[model samples]
Target chain A: MSGFCRLERDRSLATRVDGGGGVMTGALAPIALSLRGVTKRFGAIRALDGVDLEVPRGAVFGLVGPNGAGKTTTFGIACGYVRPDGGTVDLFGEGPFDPSKHRGRVAVLPQDAQLGRDIPLLDQLVYFARLQGLGKQEARSQAGWALELAGVTSRARARSRTLSHGMLKRVAIAQAFIGEAELVLLDEPTSGLDPVQAERIREHIVAQRHDRTVVVSSHNLNEIEAVCDHVAMIDHGRAVLAGTVAAITGKNEEVRITLAEGPVPLDMVKTALAGDSVDWDEASRTLVIRFVSRPGRGAEDVIGQALRTLLGHHARISQVVKGRSLERTYLESS
Target chain B: MIGPTPFRDMLLVAWFELKEMLRTRRALVVIALYLLGGLVASRVFVGVIGRLEDVAADMLQTTRTATPGALTRQVLHSDAYREALVRLFPNRNVADFLLGLPPIVLFFAWSSLAFVPFLIMMTAADTVTQEVQDRGIRFVVIRTGRVEFVLGKYLGQALLMSFVVLLTGFVYLAVAWRGLQGFEFWPTLDGILIFWPRIVVYGFAFVGLAGLCAMNARSAAVARALSFVGLTVSWVLGEMAYRWSDGIFGAAWTAIGFLVPFSHKAALWRPGVAGVLPECAVLVALGLVYLSVGLVMFRRKDL
Candidate 1:
């Protein structure tokens, strides 16, 4: 808690650098993956434009963006599928992206990349494990454990071509969890899954936060918000905003209260809550209160003051949202 | 955490590729065509030898016609066939030894030497590109080093080509058992043995070169076309070098021809292990050089 408080103070003073996505953080956990000034082009189309990202270790970092955003392309460069035309990438501060150097330490589930077509899924996982330097028997055991984590152990002997779309997606995810990788990057891990399965996958992702760094990109904003501790939102190859979930959503800076139809005593509530700025949205009859938070100033304290003032004014409050939802944040920025 | 376990990685990747190719339709078709070509070659060579036997029987006028083996052996054991073998071999003793074997075995050996290179090219052209096009290589290249991945592919295709060439020996045994008059077991087996390893070395040179094409191109069809163009360019360069051997351009043209696989085939035809062994080493060296160049380019290719 103390370390996070100091990190917040340092991040506030850090300026945005050349890359538009530069949300700075000071000496957090050892960064799991770092990209600096990365640029990429596919013919005349620019896929990525000087994008920079820092993924701290032991966090479920979400790469949130809309359709045709640079999230997948950024993953491509990190995974060495597409060589960046410019800039550098570092994994665990070790070195550049060489497959041998990064072998068992980094695992990636590329978007839409199929597994071995007719090979049994377990054997394919074993092949990947063996290449990562596991012995035959150990590779088999680890591969089985990965399949169980993905809940696909029943189809371990099935060929990839014979599986349904959701089954194959699970198999692909299973491969990423094969070895004892320190960092795992999954692109749309729960894309084709039903609601129940998607929730299970989200739990699996969050479970990795204890020992491994996980990075995921997806269109499902609710899942991202539910599972991710930190996030960086990009639009059209530029980082629009990035920070912890609390920081980006202004969870401490703002709270919204929906009041029932009554005499709207907005000025009385504003005067009662002295320095905070309050506004009313007529459509929803919700008060959006923003405050400048400082040390020892808890969000609970600000929310309590606002609630008391509104109750004293005899406003019947129906609902209260703690912060701006991630959906609204994405819509506003995108 | 990577270690100095490149050999282990290569073996694993190679085995995976070998299994993949075993189930590939392109490899199966190429193998079937090579076997069919062996059958056609056996038919054609056996007919030619049969006609020679008839001519010899007429000239000697030994109407004993009861012994087809005797007539065929006597005819091939003549000075005329010895001269023909001499023209094919660089050494006189090598020619004399080859003249003792059956004509169909010799012809089968020659056809495999001529046909196995194309088989390798066709099978290897899609080995890298199809994976790249489908992004399936993302799974592999991330697991193994780029050098090991490319080398694994070459080693996989090389071993499969060697296996396919060995299958030709069985093709010879099958055809000789059914089609020939006197198919001596030991001699026919000996000829097949000599031919298999030699042609495999020839096929090895082209497999690495075709892998070069596959790694450089993005589509399987383009890779196949490039491999054909690579083979054609090598052959045409060698032929042109020889055609102008009497001019001042001969030295440079011959040097250019030396860089390609086509110029190295003549040494493969030399008749014994001592004569052929050095060329086998050279062909392997040439294959490695082609592979080294391809690996440099493949490492730089995006995806």
Candidate 2:
């Protein structure tokens, strides 16, 4: 089996661990959403095949993939837009077939979903709020607050067709945040936005992460890395990597040492740390050391030894940084 | 907090659909067109009635000296009249009584019954297809049940068509009252009040069919085309069946004829409270069937 399949199988065993009571060390939160052996087909193409995923409550999970990776299909299944041909999907412990059971608790920001052209922005927002079970007066009030939160209060009365693409996206974001939904599924939330606007949306998502779970599916790996604490990377209809950003990226295995002066010698570092791989960039005066420790030895032990050796050699070290970047990890995994 | 009940959700969807219709200005345009059509039809009917009255007077002077009631019976029971009634209202003698009504009433009843379906098709053709094409249905479907969404759209279209039919009925009544000053107020008002509700029910049958078409079609243009084509095909087949009702294919043609709305046009002029009940039941059944099929298809369709 592929690595993702093995990970998925292991997750089922982990679910049986039951609140850190067995060999597992930490308490695992109850799953907010789960998919088991889900499969879908369109004509000859298999969109999703035997896919399994689990999202814990109170997590900012990122679903990352390249084009045609079934990210949008998975989102559609969760929101009850696309029906699966086999297996099952559960949201908040309810089957995907019945979203109304979790109404007002789940909201979706579908990528490129256009608002009704003739509907005023405020009216459209209010209508969505009312669909979440708010009364007319409360729906109107909350719509106003949602618009303000999305920073589109100035265009509240504008018809959706009259707004630009960026403005429409903001309106859709406001519509998703209405009723303070417990689980927000945002598919490509910042797919088409300027860097500044994308940053603002990222900050908004991070701010909202303290209370409710947010599942964001995006091709923007950098944005995913910046916002996500937990992530699952799907490729060609199967999840290739699924874990905390730190664990999946293997950020703990490497350390970066920045020297005060230029020309840190690679040979000196290589002789000092025998088994570790070291790369010295003479122009930047930085040494990147990759540690491959044995089981239970840990990267910290190796790093400590290297620190003492560098100090003994009288090397001027300015700063130490840890962990691999997510981009590199994503490229290696996919 | 509790979410909306299925019934409440359906109502909310209907309310939103109605608001969308108004916001898009389609509702106002449809209503104005229906009323204007009714006025123009009533005027043409008045001119036709005047010429027919003069012809009837000349025929009375030339005929044998018979009682007025006998003359009326002769005119209605003639072979030509019977054949015309059979062509319009198959397996029924109700048109005999319909023929005795005022010329203006007959014209209004026939014209409204004949044209209301097209009016409904025009108004409701984009009801579901527009949202699906624009991907706006994603927002509402997540919040409410699919069954409720279909029901709401169907109900909203039915309600709009009902309003249009009712307004046209009043316009016809006003035109008839002013043009035919000798006509009695209570009877003409009663005839209109009785006729328009049945027209509204018939209008709903078309609305339901249009909703089904819209749900399956890929775009607003396709929905309109499908509705138009479906109605035209059904109408042409119904005409053929009626025309060929006396041959070896008589039984099959007659059976197929009843499936078309045009086959029930005579029911619009049926007198008394219970006269249109059977036809109303059939129209309601058609509406239910269309709506049920639409809901089934929409529930399984990908959005």
Using lDDT, give the best candidate's number. 1
Q: Which tens-of-lDDT digit does each residue in B1-303 have in candidate 2? A: 223477887888888888788777766787788889998988776655555555686876664322122333355558897778768875455666666565555666678888988887887887888888878899998787788888888788787777777777777777767765355567667666667788888877777777766678878899999989878876887798889988899999988777766666656566665877888888787777877887788888888
Candidate 1 whole-model C-alpha lDDT, 0 to 1: 0.78
Off by over 4 Å in 1: A1-29, A262-268, A294-297, A304-315, B1-4, B47-70, B87-90
Number of the top candidate by TM-score? 1
DockQ of predictions, in order shown: 0.44, 0.45
Best by DockQ: 2
| lDDT, residue B118, candidate 2 | 89
TM-score of chain A of each: 0.87, 0.80
The digit string of per-residue lDDT tens for model 1 on A1-334 reads 1000000111221232211122334563488889888888889888888888999989899998978789999888888778888888888786567765577767888888878776788888899878876667767887777677656777788778887888777767767877666688999988878887787778778877857799999889988999999999977776778889888888888889899988678888788777888999999889998887889876777778878877877878898887899889878877
A1-334: candidate 2 lDDT, tens digit per residue: 1000000111112211111112323553478788888888888889888778998888899999889989999998888889899988887665674645567768899877889888888988888877777768877887877677666777789888897787788778767877656689999988777776788788878876657789999988888989998999888888888989877766667787888863455676688788788887677677888876577767677677667877767778888766666787889887
Clashing pairs for predicted structure model 1, backbone only: none
Point out the worst 10-residue segment of candidate 2 chain B by lDDT.
B64-73
